[model samples]
Target chain A: MSQVLVVTSGKGGVGKTTTTAALGAAIAVTGQTVVVVDFDVGLRNLDLVMGAERRVVYDLINVVQGIAKLPQALIRDKRIDTLSLLPASQTRDKDALTDDGVARVIKELRAKFDWVICDSPAGIERGATLAMRYADAAIIVTNPEVSSVRDSDRIVGLLDSKTKKAELGERIEKHILITRFDAARAARGEMLNIKDVLDILSLPLLGIIPESEEVLRASNLGTPVTLNDPTSAPARAYCDAACRLLGQDLPMVIPNDRKSIFEKLLGRRAA
Target chain B: MSVLGLFRLRGTAPVARERLHILLSHERSNRGRPDLLAILRDEILAVVAKHVSVDHDQVHVTMDRGQIVSRLEINVELQHPANGPIAAEREKAAMTIVHQASR
Candidate 1:
């Protein structure tokens, strides 16, 4: 069976959708068949992020409602042959998805693909819960802030209670992906540090994506940073995260600009 | 003075000390732990009262580090009317409140 990974965050605009796209592209590049499913429903931003917005004929709701088949709804990525996207509906009908229908679709996807990556909507609501209901594992994306971390805690609680694994008494592996990490801000005590976020979330770190202009630039161009600029810092971080997801032991690097001024001043004073 | 001593002195100076005090206070108040503890205490009291009489004064709910662990010492007190036969029923409610608060 394929591994179903849900990219979720209780707070919005924390790179859950971007992480889903980047990780999906990265995993697909490894010769594995990967499908990135957008469960954002009305917002439907993942297709644009994946540069498949123009190719979206049928969406996730159509597939679930039996109006369209999986193959019809799945849009193959033009850049990467192995990667595909199942876009979300533009309609605002919240009741479009049924529980049993979603389960069946996930089961079918599991049989067909190596990795089924679901991009969950923001907040701990029905859209978010249903996206994660069938997940075998989760990437809990969070920003380096108290509100985002606190919201992530709520999502973690939901993952423990609402997932199929949780209902069946099986363990669903969860990893924390801290995105938009500004080392300079962290050094200046403006944003939460990686260590502080880890101490609060207590989940194993999957990746630390630094706040970079590359992410915004790539998103504007309808491409994931990992694919748009593979050599960029954010791209490298996402690649490392993908490797970690495959159970590789990659050494963690403390993003560069996190050196504290106190330490620097002390060193200078000593010298 | 040694460089380390000077650093320590700087760290403990009035300006740094004031900054530390203000920052610590802000962090603590913004943590939202107290609000969560209050909610937990209310929920616990509601559930416990369904089984036995609980001493409200003895209800202790506190957060340590970032986890919410509550202790409720319920002193069951039964009072019978003078005109009726004194009877007490023993019932155990199987409700466990496991609260793990984190941020």
Candidate 2:
């Protein structure tokens, strides 16, 4: 059976979009058919990150409003045959996405794909709520910062109260993905450590994506980091997260940001 | 303490953790019982006032957070009957019996 998962973060700019694309691509690389639906209606950019922007002749709103069919709107990935994208309409606002319309699209996607990942917009408004309305599980993206962690706690409450599972009194499986984590900064007490975030949210840790320039480079080139630079730190972290999502019991690999041996030796000599 | 220790004492992590604790508790209790305690206070007041002259406005109910268990405190002040009337002794005797029988 297919699972509908929402990649969500209450605070903006906390990497909900990046995590969606990377996990979708990583899962697809494992030969699972995955379709990532962009739920950021007015600020649609999942297609750009997935390198399917030019191929988006029709979008989610078009399919929802009956102007286009699902097959016609789904942009199949060129590199990964099993990966696809349902791009959001940049021209339309969130009002264009009706609750019934999203449910229909999600049901259809669930029937066709092994994983249907919804890329939720920031905030707890209609756009974000609708994104998580049909999710069987949620991957909450958070930064190792005070505001992000606090907002994530709010989202956690919503996950318990405002979802269909919540309405039915069923549990929606939740996992926390800490992004933009700087280990050295955390050690210096500049950023919250992973344990601190975990203690506050009390959700299981998914994987930690270290702050890396490779993520910016990948997004700039219209590619997911996992596929763009598979060997990079962020990409490896995302890959591990995707595996964990697939029920693999791999130990989490926390990336270190300590100074290199050469740098430390040079600093000692200079001193 | 060193200056660094002072900064650590006032660090954002500790502050954030404490804030989230209070916020989450308030949120959880609000979600489960936003008006339940008030209704309960009113009901208890109605039952008590039937026998004893109690001030309706004096009924206060509060829930205090505790380590292993939450505490619910209810305070209600009883009013004395006017003019040393016979009804005062009867009401007091009834209240005493009610309290003792419950105990």
True contacts kept of 2: 0.27
Give the per-residue lDDT of model 1 (tens digit) for B51-84.
Answer: 6555455344444332233333333333333334
lDDT of 2 by residue, A67-146 (tens): 99999999999999999999999999999989999999999999999999999999999999999999999999999887
The docking category that best describes candidate 2 is: incorrect
lDDT by residue for model 1 (A1-271), tens:
5899999999999999999999999999998999999988999999999988889899999999999999999999999999999999998554787889899999999989999999999988888999999999999999876668777877887898898899999988999999988876677555677877776668999999998778988999999878997877888899999999887999986443233688686764211
RMSD to truth, every model: 10.8, 8.4
Whole-model lDDT per candidate: 0.80, 0.85
Q: Per-residue error at B55 for model 2, in Å?
A: 33
Q: True contacts preserved, each candidate?
A: 0.00, 0.27
Q: Where does candidate 2 chain A have its weakest 10-residue lDDT segment?
A: A262-271
